[model samples]
Target: MGVHSVNWEPFLTCAVTGAGDTLSKHPDLPVTPEQIATAAIEAAEAGAAIVHIHVREPATGKGCREVAYYREVVERIRDSGVEVLINLTTGMGGDVVVGDRGGEDTPAPGSDFVGAMERLVHVEQLRPDLCSLDCGSLNFDDDRLVYVMPPAYLRPSAARIRELGVKPEMEVFDLGHVAFASRLVAEGLVEPPALFQLCLGISYGAPSTPAAMVAMRDHLPEGAVWSAFGLGRMEMPMVAQAMLLGGNLRVGLEDNLWLRRGVLASNADLVRRAKAIVEDLGGRLASPKEAADRLGLPPA
Candidate 1:
């Protein structure tokens, strides 16, 4: 589908915070659970139907996979009485950093690889409305680090995530990843009308362009509900591209820090901008309840 088949009513998601090391780049990036929750609330108010969450170490500002941090963030969001759906990330604990190029079969010192179940500890405990299921491994924006998620790990993780009654937003960074995700859906691991998030513009992944978004959308499994986002400067452009291609929209500090060339943006700022683009294109923003129904998720 292309501009001829635009998604007239699309839901918007705000990745309130990500697991990336963006603290030094943006001083106001949400670090503590309190700050993250506040950001989520603000993003929801600005027009996000769903808020994607990733917890960080309060003191160091580095992402951590602790259940305590996840729990606190979830609890705070719940207490605020916001009507936005929560989408927690399960993309952590899959890094495999190799040291030397010659003879290093063993994982390097910075590797954080763990079993599938171990990575979902937070999702299993918090049971958010949605959680990411990174479909395949990729060179994680750096030569030395590769985010590893082979089928051996993904099959079991998909089953467990289904058992927990939470929707898994299959995250596809490349075309091959989309094929593997289709295989998982064929195996009945992902529920009917499986959800996908096309991650564009990361290193060694699909570029953030209209052609790339159209290619990924064409390759998606039949009846799959998908959204797409670009990194850095491509973030806003993909918003219009994805919406025009019959897909949903996503924008946040997690993907791009700049509202413009030199101005830093909060999650809410990005969401508001995306909302305007959607409206300008004659598209209606879906409410949280509407998005939940479309994705087959329980109410937030």
Candidate 2:
């Protein structure tokens, strides 16, 4: 279906905090579990139907894969009585840093590569309504840092997520990732009416542009639900582009740190701004209930 032919009630997703080391870049970035949960609640109140989450180390403000942190954040959001859908990140535990010239077998201090089952520990424990599954590996913004998500790893991870009854939001960074995701759908690994998130404008991924967004949208499986977002300045532009192209929207400090030049933004600020753009364009924002139905998620 072409962009205009598809339905266009935009559902906003506030990616509350990502695994990126942006603590130093922005003073208001949520680090601790309490902070992250508060930001998520505020974003939902500001018009986001879904909140993408990543837990960080409270001490150092670095992203870490700990179930305790995830539990705390999820509990807080649930206890707060917000209606937003929780989408946790399973994209961590895949960082692989190659050592210097002499240390071929030895990985760097930051390298963390574990099995598929180990990576999904938090998802299994918390059982969020949605969780992210990176479709393929790529040079994660730097040559030395590789994000490893081989097909062998993805098959089992997708299966496990399905078994846990959590919808996997397949994260596609490039055309090849989309193809692989299609394979997962074909193999019956991913649930029917597969969902995707087209991630653009990282260091070595697809360029963030209207043409690139359209091309990637075209590559998705038939009737698949998808959302797209870009990094840095392209964040808001892609928000509008995704809505125009018959998909949902995602915005947060995870993708872009600033609302404008010299202005650091909170997740709520980004969602509020995106809500305005969607409304001014004659597109209505989806509520949490509406979003769950559109994305094939069970009632919250």
Candidate 3:
């Protein structure tokens, strides 16, 4: 396969609702199952071939791992006949918050660490087209908040995802994380044509820059399909950059919450803007079926 060949056709992924603390920040963030499904469908209609989903607690709007929420969201999307691929988030349930400085043994109130099996419950039950497997852990935003994904945890999670006949989208936050994912592929834990999402511009991780993105892209294993995204203002810029680098692009309220300064964005708006940028640059947007074929995914 010509890994570095220019990708004149790009696929867009709209991350409908991320498992972040953005409910209060964005007034229109999709919290309920119905709302989330609507947003996903709208995004697909606006040129998103895939929708990366993360369910939140309907009442409190906090991120949760409730299988019912995922079921409802998936059912609505599938029932709508939108022809979009589903990529569920298995990266939740691994958050760890450090408690008082002196009380190292005690985890903070928000910490919710669980085994791999618990994280995969929705993926196993719903059997989405793809599920994310975070490659490694790091301090999410600051010293107090950390996201944990050790190799021991990832191996079993990857194995289970494979057994379920679902594709695992390895989320790599840094160079080391990419190396670890390569190890998983080398060990045959991750299936061939490994998929990776290069996550950049988050706190304490790789910066969102052209140089950094190219570095990560260069490190990807041969025949591996990769995509990259940056948070906040870097979102649209990275969309073009990732496509120019011969990879796909992602956008939504999950990574960014604004269409412009002082303007809030819905998932559909983000996807539309990204679509416009992709097309304006002489790149064709891939439909759901086209994206699936390129990624070696079965039709939706």
Candidate 4:
């Protein structure tokens, strides 16, 4: 799918809950396996073609990197009869933080523990139709931690992704990440007609704005299918913005937990609202089959 010269309808994906704070932030956010599966089904019913999942610990709301949890979640979603595509996160394992004054400080809490193979382990085991490969590292989360995905790390991960036959959503926060992703494709680590997700409005990486969105979208490699999202207040607006610009739209509690101020949002609510937004703007939203075709995902 080229960035241009194609008749594009905005394909919506609900990012449900990311691997971040949920117990304190939103009361309705899905934590248990049952909750997660139900939320995903509701999102699919509400017109989200894909559900971007980040599993959590059943007891604590802490994000879990457990493969078993992911397997159970996938099972529940499959048995529930929802036709949406499952896009797992290969992003959680690669976080790195260094302490001040080298070894003197107590190693400022690093999430970057595993290499690409370890990062790709769950995906290889579960084999979701789509999985995210955070193209490069940035200073993610508040209070100094890095979500590191160096190219040396990415090459093997991308290769593993291809080996499993899962579509990799190359998440680019800036133009340089886009360039590096293209390099990955050229190096044959990533396959032709790659898929990308242009993540915007995160702390200390890139601001969510129209001009910046366009500039980054314009920079994607030819024949690549891409999606974009903005955090907080820009979330809904960026949905419409991405549609108008001929890219896909992504939304959910991962980026923001509100349908409006003080109104808690479920994954379904987010998807229903996005469906309405595109419709209001004289654009149509894609069905699961349409989205799968658009992103080269297998038929449902």
lDDT of 2 by residue, 1-300 (tens): 554543358888899889888999998899999999999999999999999999999999999999999999999999999899999999989998887763765478788888889999999999999999999999986658989999889999999999999999999999999999989999999987798999999888888999998989898888898999999999999988998888899999999999899989999999989999888788888999998998788766
Each model's lDDT:
0.92, 0.91, 0.92, 0.84
Per-residue C-alpha lDDT of model 4 across residues 1-300, encoded as one tens digit per residue: 243532247778889789776679898889887788788889888998888988888888878788888888899999888888999998887766767776665346644467778877789899998999988888877776777889898888888899889988898988889989988888888886798898999787667998988888888777777889999879999998888887899999898888898898888888888889888887788888998887777775
Among all windows of ten consecutive residues in candidate 2, which has the lowest summed lDDT?
A: 1-10
Model 3 gets an lDDT of 0.92
Single out the weakest 10-residue window by summed lDDT for candidate 3.
Answer: 1-10
**Better by lDDT, candidate 2 or 1:** 1
- TM-score each candidate: 0.97, 0.97, 0.97, 0.95
lDDT of 3 by residue, 49-117 (tens): 999999999999999999999999999999998899999999888998887764766478888999989
Candidate 2 regions exceeding 4 Å error are 1-7, 102-105
**Which candidate model has the greater lDDT, 2 or 4?**
2
Where is model 1 poorest over a 10-residue stretch in terms of lDDT? 101-110
